[model samples]
Target chain A: MDIVIGVDIGGTKTKIGLVDQNGECLEQTFFRTQDFPNLTNYLDQIKITSDELIQKLGKEVNILGCGIGAPNASSKNGTIENASNLVWKESVPIIEKLKERMPMPMRIMNDASAAALGEMLFGGAKNMTDFIVITLGTGFGAGIVANGKLIDGYDGFAGELGHVDMTLGDGRLTGLGVRGGLEAYVSATGLKRTIMYMLSKYMVESRFRDVAYNDLHGEDITKAAEEGDEIALKAFDYTARVMGLALANFTAFTQPEAFILMGGLTNSGKWIMEPLERYFNANLLEVYKGKVKLMYSKMEGKTAAICGAAALIWEIQDKPS
Target chain B: MDIVIGVDIGGTKTKIGLVDQNGECLEQTFFRTQDFPNLTNYLDQIKITSDELIQKLGKEVNILGCGIGAPNASSKNGTIENASNLVWKESVPIIEKLKERMPMPMRIMNDASAAALGEMLFGGAKNMTDFIVITLGTGFGAGIVANGKLIDGYDGFAGELGHVDMTLGDGRLTGLGVRGGLEAYVSATGLKRTIMYMLSKYMVESRFRDVAYNDLHGEDITKAAEEGDEIALKAFDYTARVMGLALANFTAFTQPEAFILMGGLTNSGKWIMEPLERYFNANLLEVYKGKVKLMYSKMEGKTAAICGAAALIWEIQDKPS
Candidate 1:
């Protein structure tokens, strides 16, 4: 049997797993990302954990490569360059360190791009040559696949769909200091802000009204929307409208076959999906009408992160440098 | 000698030329586009004129192919699908008809895509893999070249950069009926609207105040800006700010090595370019700072259009279908 090691590095936790071609995660473990103050410490931990896995299972299965996904990572040089969420203060040449530990082919890319590769290889977008995968977590991020390959721009920053300015005037201030970006309106943080704005603008009283602005999260709105809370429903509606419109704008540029949605916001299921579909179709150009489909990611929870990491290596292996 | 025939179809004139491998236009001629009210008539005239050119120079040179450029043309199907600017009311199977007459390898591409290929082949972008060519004429159009190829997407409309929504609210209405699109602001037509908006918003007095709205063109503002007219200066400044901001936004997505400007607006020269360069650099992400260059198209006037059309054939000869 052959397998690839998939590693997803988040601010709080890092997940490592062995993934097969069928998109199965055979075995997995986790460690605290914050504990590693620098790249050396992080690589040391990765080495120890991987060695333990190899000792137990490496005898039976051959390891192909290691695929890693981290915030602000560079695929070209395999470096995590100034990821704000990570404790590493400067650029970390993680691939070089990983090579020293295992002497294997290893690559790193932005987490969102990994997720897109995951979808193309194992999830909802297996058949799609041209489509976009948008992840809605604490923030919104996207990966573009055009011509059956990742649209990794010259700087490996091709699919910053959420960063596009959707606001004409004063809107939400993004962490990047730009205002009215789609991420500021569609992500978990953006959803909470929408709830707050709905509370003030419509004076809609519902269960969500009981939640404080700072204390609120994406789950609360999903919970309330399930309970048929008016404010919660309104908030999702607003989020969907903005999401749909942004997808329309995006379609004019790439005319993707579908947009696969992933992340915590997807918990609301049809509540968020229906309006998004309606508005996306409505805003699309007449020529492109009823063409681009909106789909939910088939890869869920830990499966998404693990499969995406494995797919990263599978994707670039055939690419011409 | 080897040559390709280039045909650029515009609203007022149809320019046809013989382009050699060296990017030289050996000979050129024009036909009144208004004279051909139907596709049949247009093709009939094209066949006769081209046959004449072949008879005169066929012995001296080898004509490899014919490349045609027009608005609303689809490269995938080689058809002009309902070009609003053209007299033909339905889809025109242009390549099929042109091939029937010439019996040589022929192709059709969106004019902007042809321009991008032209730049890569003959203009300033020969060595670059990732770059964009923007034609700012009556409308704004873009052609994206990444990974040493065009980003043609699933369909052929991959590089409609001008249609991106720049305004959060109702700013300007595009021909496509979208509001505040980049095309509605940065184009030569958009520049005139900016002037009109400036006149209404600032109530400024300048030479441009006397020109009727219908009579005003982009050159008037360029002429006025040269004379240091306050209103015209403000208009170009405003247009540059919007254009630069849009390019900055585009850079985040593509991270091209440069953006080559073509079409009538380039005639404004440093008046439009200096501000565009200033703002494009200012708004780019920190990593992309000073990386994307702002370049003027090397081909000028009819040369750009003719070379672009010829380059369309040259481009596809080596591409994977």
Candidate 2:
């Protein structure tokens, strides 16, 4: 059997896995990402983790290559450029360093793109040729696949779906200095904004009102909704409605087969999916009505990002070079 | 000297031409499309024209094949289904009909898609791998090319830029019964709407005041703008501002190398391009700030569509089969 190394580099921790073609992680481990503040230190830790995994899997499987998924990582440039959350202040040529050390075929893609590839290779989108995958984390990000190939664009920053402007008026402003961007209404941050607005608008008492504004988090709101809180429920409905309308607009542009959603937001389950389906179908054009499905990522905890990283290698082989 | 036949079928006229590999029309002729009411009559007329053209150029050139560009044409199914402007009420199997009559290699594509092929083959985007060609006529249309191929979705309607929803509120309604679509703000019909709104807002007396509301046209506004009409200038600015912002949103999605503008609106020249460039730059994301260029189509009138039709055959040969 052929095995591949999957690496998911997060702000606080880095997860490494020995993965097979079927998206199964035979063995996996993690290290404290924050412990290594600089680029060299973090890279050294990655090398150590990879070497340990290779030594254990070497006897049973032929190692194919390694796939790394990183935030702000560019596939075309093979560099992680100025990731705000990471300690690396400058662009790190991670792909070059890996190639020099291991001297094998490897690829580094944006985390969202990698997750999309994982969905196509191992999750619900296995049978779909054209689809969209969105990771609604602290910030929203997307990976768009058209006609069975990921859209890398000329400079490799093609799938910036989160930044698409929805309106230009006195709506919410984004980190990118744009007003009413999709991210301003359809992300975890956006959901929190919705929660704040809901709390202010409705006079009804709720558990969310007890928490301070700065202390509130996404999970707290989800928990509140799960516990049958009205304000929280309305917040979730607002987020899902905006997201569904954005998805419907995107559908009009590319007419994807489905939209695979990952990250913390999907944990809301039917709260998100149910309202999303209603708005998506309502806003979709006549020809595309009821055609595209909204699906949640099927990969289990912690493994989802790791599986996506490893799936990148498999996806390269699946597509025509 | 390889030669190909290019056919551009319009609602009123059909232009047929024998084109060379260099995108030069060797010979051309046209016939009134309204002369024939049914698909059979129009197709039979096309066969007759092709025979005549071939007979005229047979001895001097090596004929390759034929290419046809039509409205609401689906390259995937090779059928023209319910084209609103066309007289044919039912779906016409255009490709099959052409194949049976000519017994040669041929392909049919949407008019905008064909025009995009023409631009790539003979215009400013000759070296661009990813770009968009937008035709702003009676209706707005788009042909998206990514990784050096036209994005024909699973159902052959992938690049519907015109129909992309621009707003979620009670904005301009499109002929297709959609609200706030890009076409509702950027096409010839959209321009007329802009003019009417401008006339109502400002108390300025101009040539437009003398003309009846129903008799007003897009050209009247442009001509007035040329003669220094304030309302007309505002109308053009509004159209450009909205279109530029939409292009910026599209840039965030696909991040194409350039946006090539064609059709009647390009005749407005700097009034449109200047504002479009300014707004496109302002609304663009940081990384994509100076990357995507907005270009004008190089293919001249009458010949442009014809060249595009013939270029479809060449495009097929260029791509790996």
Candidate 3:
């Protein structure tokens, strides 16, 4: 079967995998992405990983396509345009350079958009035409699939749902001048803020207090919530409320069939999902009360991101050149 | 040239017209819609108007289709559901009934959806693939056209931008039963409330005091503003600011090409548009600071609705049916 290589480049780690038609990944490799000083160095590491994977497979597999999923990748420009998390000076032509090195048809998309396509192809929202996929990582990120197609508007910046203002009046302030953006109260950073507020109010002492501010991770907080920690539970509750209200607002506007929640924090499952479902149902239109289901990503472990990036190639396989 | 019959059914009037492929209305007629107590009466009036129009202008014209625009119409079901202003008891099979009466293929869609399609086809957003059409009438309504298609979700209930809860805290007692909704703060009824609040704050008396509460009209307030009234301008400014912020929030999410403003209140022009534009620009993402445009609808008066309704049929024509 013809296979394509999928590369998911993140700030902390990078995943590479070989995927075929049905979104099945045969083999995958993981590496620390932060070891590289610049993008070219990062590309060199990716190339080495890809070559190693190809050599280990034995058979000379036909490389049909390649897809790169990066943090701030601009699909329209086919470059990673100054991802603050990644050490890039300006726009990095990863796709162009990769194409020259491997000599195969290739495309690149933002990580959230790629993850959304992966969800539509293989994860919770499989077979659904209209849905939303949100990556609840460092900051909340969203990609919209409307009327069965990805919403890549002029300049390919259509589905920035994370920036949709959540609070109206003199509420929370976002990094941007805008107040109450979805990311301001729903992302990993937002969750930390929620936890700090809860900690101050409840006067609770926890292991989290010993962790450095920058080192405080979402996984650690989720672990705390899973252990029935009240402060962590409050944090999850606040995140669920903000996220649920955001989802309800999005549903009222777009009326999607489902909302697929992804990223690290969702590992807490019932802690976040149960409360989110409750708030979402309460806030949704009466007719749409139970129609839209809130689902979690089915794909887990190292292969999900690479598998999603590979799914992007399969999606555009039949498109007119 | 192939032509289509466009019909706009409103609470007080029913407008029927012959529209050509170029979106030009060749012949038109209007009748009192409120006089009809049953669906049969309404259908019969349409029959009378259709026959008269055909008889006056040769009956052998190449009529391509018929399209109806109505309040609370469902593009998915092709029915006019129970609209608050209408006397209908339940959902009316508008498309099927009209097709039977006229013996022609027809389609039906919501007035807001039709207006959005009209703007895409013949109004200010002629070349835009992604834009929102906001109708500022009795209620705040929106029709979102994204990626060159109307976002009719699972139940054709998408693009309810008006119902998105605007109030943040204890929304149950607020205007839309959950904080501030676009309709709660932007519609004619909402604007009336704004005027009333302003009147109480400023303790001003004008022609507004002369008109009884129930009989008060949106135009009367606009006329007062037109004659250089401060209280009326303040009322308009509040609406403009809120609407501007709403648009900013919308653009951040969808990143549409433009915002095509329609409906009656839009007649106020700069009184609302200037401040709305200012607030919207101030709150937009940095990259999108000067990118998105805001424009008024080119199609106005009764024909606007008719042309907009006809656009649904034109849209279907371009689809792979």
Q: What are the interface RMSDs of all the models?
A: 2.1, 1.8, 2.0
Tens digits of per-residue lDDT for model 2 on B192-240?
A: 7888888899998777777776787767777898899988888888999
A99-143, model 1: which lDDT tens digit per residue?
Answer: 999777788887788998999888888888888888777667787
Which pairs in model 1 have colliding backbones? A168-B168
Error of 3 at B237 (Å): 2.3
Model 1 chain B: weakest 10-residue lDDT segment is: B81-90
lDDT of 2 by residue, A64-150 (tens): 888988776788989876564467755788999877777767888877889888988898888777888888875677888887888
Model 3 chain B: weakest 10-residue lDDT segment is B167-176
Docking class of 1: medium
lDDT against the true structure, per candidate, is 0.79, 0.80, 0.77
Better of 2 and 3 by lDDT: 2
DockQ values of all predictions = 0.55, 0.51, 0.52
True interface contacts reproduced, per candidate: 0.54, 0.54, 0.56
Quote the positional error of residue B83 for candidate 2 in Å. 5.0
Candidate 1 lDDT over residue span B1-321, tens digit each: 888899988655787888888788877778988899977889888877776666766567888899987876778888887554567756788898878878998887877888888998989999998888888877787888877887776777677766677765357777767777778888888888888888898876788778888899777888899998888888888888888878877776667889898888889988898888887776665656777888888886767887899997776666787
lDDT of candidate 1?
0.79
Off by over 4 Å in 1: A11-13, A29-59, A82-90, A97-103, A168-170, A315-321, B11-13, B31-37, B44-61, B87-90, B97-103, B316-321
